[model samples]
Target: MPDLAISATGLTKTFGGVPAVRGIDLAVPAGSIYGILGPNGAGKTTTLRMLLGIIDPDGGERRILGSADPLAVAPLVGYLPEERGLYPGMTGREAIAFMGALRGLSLAEGRRRAVALLADHGLPADRPIRTLSKGMAQLVQLLGTMVHEPRLIVLDEPFSGLDAINQQRLEGLIRAQAAGGATILFSTHVIAHAERLCERIAIIAGGEVRFEGEIATARARLPSRVRLSTKVADGAWHAALPADAVLRDGVWQFQLPQGGIEPLLAALIDAKAGIETLAIEPPSLHEAFVAIVGAEPDPVAEALS
Candidate 1:
């Protein structure tokens, strides 16, 4: 197993006597992309804030980058908050350099790295942030977050407000960072991004963890499906299918049996049924997420307590 980049045990938080994040455990391995997934108000942002030492947890403990005091090792961690914060009057280069400076980079070294990062992302280093488009400015903020080359990157709602094209760009950047051996921990209510990028994930619901494990394991909670279409619409072979099978769009779709598909295949063969199509469909992350969390929560609910 890889070394842990972030670990939390019994982490809890509350606001005005109301629990926002109940005791939760997390283990994020180094060099892996881990996602904290849930709808709004699931305590994702609160949990991240506690883990990053931005706020004190009401209970439990957290270790970041192996340091008991994450604030002490702040230089080794990069954070992109849900609220986009960039000085409008600062030039793109200055903005990036400012972030690097906070992480212990000298002004001169920060400027040097900022220039290269701006050019690499196709942003003009000298352009003031006020003159840049919203998407461009957001990218600039992300560049600033990464300018110091921190070992662990924590982002809250990174995809929020990004257009489809910019969202795709962000995804590529995340992959590139992980390829370079950075351990990334990001929280998102948007499930698709996590589904595509995460190796492991923790699902939060009602301010508590619903599940935590490999993405494949979460998906395995739901059974695979088999859609079969036979030459004859109704036959003895139909008896071999589960009682819950539903015929839709000229195909009989049902959950695969526990023992295996072999029994069903054999039963069909014995009935001498002419089969036109037999397709097995694995459960999707969305299906798994829904199964774990039940109905989706309100999208605009407050995630922070």
Candidate 2:
């Protein structure tokens, strides 16, 4: 098996006598981008806190960077929590440098790195964080998270408040970090972000992990959809179509056959059916998530209640 930056088995947590996370398992491969995908209040934050040692799991075990105690490897991990904050009076550079100092980086080196990071991202480093826009402030904090050049990066709802442009920029930054040999794990409710970035993902609902594995694996749980248009539909080829095939808006829509499309293609050709168009679409991540989790109550809210 490949090296793992983070691993957990049967992790569980409770808040106020109510279950918040229930028997979660995860294996985050080194240098890979993984995602925890779920709706709001799905216990994502609780699970992450447990893995990072900020909160203890009620049951199960976790290892970070080959160490059983996550705190022992603190300097190697960078984290941006869902709740964002920075000293309002501190300049962007100072804020970043302070965060780096907490992680054992020298203030001078941190400031230097902060300058370069801000310049590269077209953000102002000398201005007080309170004077910056919300997106800018968030980006500064994210830069702080990376100032020490951590081996693993964790982001909680990282894209929650950004506009489309900033969100795209953040996505690019995530890709660049992963390219630089950092293991990145982020939690987000937006399916599009996870679909675009994650090599593997865990889908959570009702405080439980409903699915986990490669994105393609999740998508493959559902059959590919086939849309075919033919001039001669009333023929032997009709027998090749699926039993539930529906003809609507000049197209025959059905699930791809288990035997594959080759047999159907042969039947269509043998019957001289004039195939106008044929398209096969695999299930999207959104569709897979819905199929796995259905509609569940917000676990965090339930816990609070």
Candidate 3:
């Protein structure tokens, strides 16, 4: 087994006598990108806080970077919370340096790193935070989270407010961080980001984990779907399709059989059903998430409502 950067077992927390996280467990492999996915109010932020020791759990245990005490390993970890803020009067460079100072980096070194980070990411280092756009300010805070080059990085809803272009840029930055050997754990309500970036994911809803493991494994919980279009209205090939198959607009749709599609394809060919189009699509992360959580219109929209 690989070394774990963060691990928790049965971690529980309640706020104002209401449960926010219930018996959550996680094992994040070092140098891997892991996503904690759920809808709003699904305990993702609470679980992240407990793992970082920002708040004490009502029950269960957790370890960070091999230490039972998360605070003791603070300098090795960088975190960007769900709520974002920076001193309004401070320049982008100054804000980054301040965050670094809080994590044990010298102010001088922090300033130096901030200058380079801003230039590398195409941001103005000397501009006051108030003057920057919302996305730019968020990016500035994110740069601060990495100024010290910590071994592990944790982000809560890092992509929440960004526009499409910035969201893509942030994804690239995340991939770059993991490539540099830092373990990244981020929480997101957006499935597409997790689908594109995470090697493994944990799906949480109603304060509990519904699924966890590789993207492929979660997707495999549902059978592949097949969409086939034929020129003929009726033919012997119809029998070759699964019982669940339905015809609509000259197309046949069904679950791919357990015996696979080769046999069905041969049968269709023999009958010369004039196959116009055929596609076998694996279950998407969005579909798997819906199946697991029983949410419609996707979790993000459902959560907002």
- Model 1 pairs in collision: none
User: 1-305 in candidate 3: lDDT tens per residue?
Assistant: 59999999999988899999999989999999999999788999999999998999999999999999999999999999999999999999999999999999999999999999999999999999999999999999999999999999999999987888888889999999999999999998888889999989999998999998999999999999999997776889777889999989778899989999998899889998888899999999888998998884344533432
Q: C-alpha displacement of 43 in model 3, angstroms?
A: 0.6
lDDT at position 152, candidate 3: 97
TM per candidate comes to 0.93, 0.92, 0.95
Worst 10 residues of 1 by lDDT: 296-305
Model 2: lDDT to the true structure: 0.92
For model 3 the local lDDT of residue 5 reads: 94
Question: Taking the tens digit of each residue's C-alpha lDDT, what string does model 1 give over 229-295?
Answer: 8876666777778887999999989998887788778877787778789999999887898899997
TM-score preference between candidates 1 and 3, better one: 3
Question: In candidate 2, what residue range of length 10 has the lowest lDDT sum?
Answer: 296-305
Clashing pairs in 3: none
Clashing pairs in 2: none
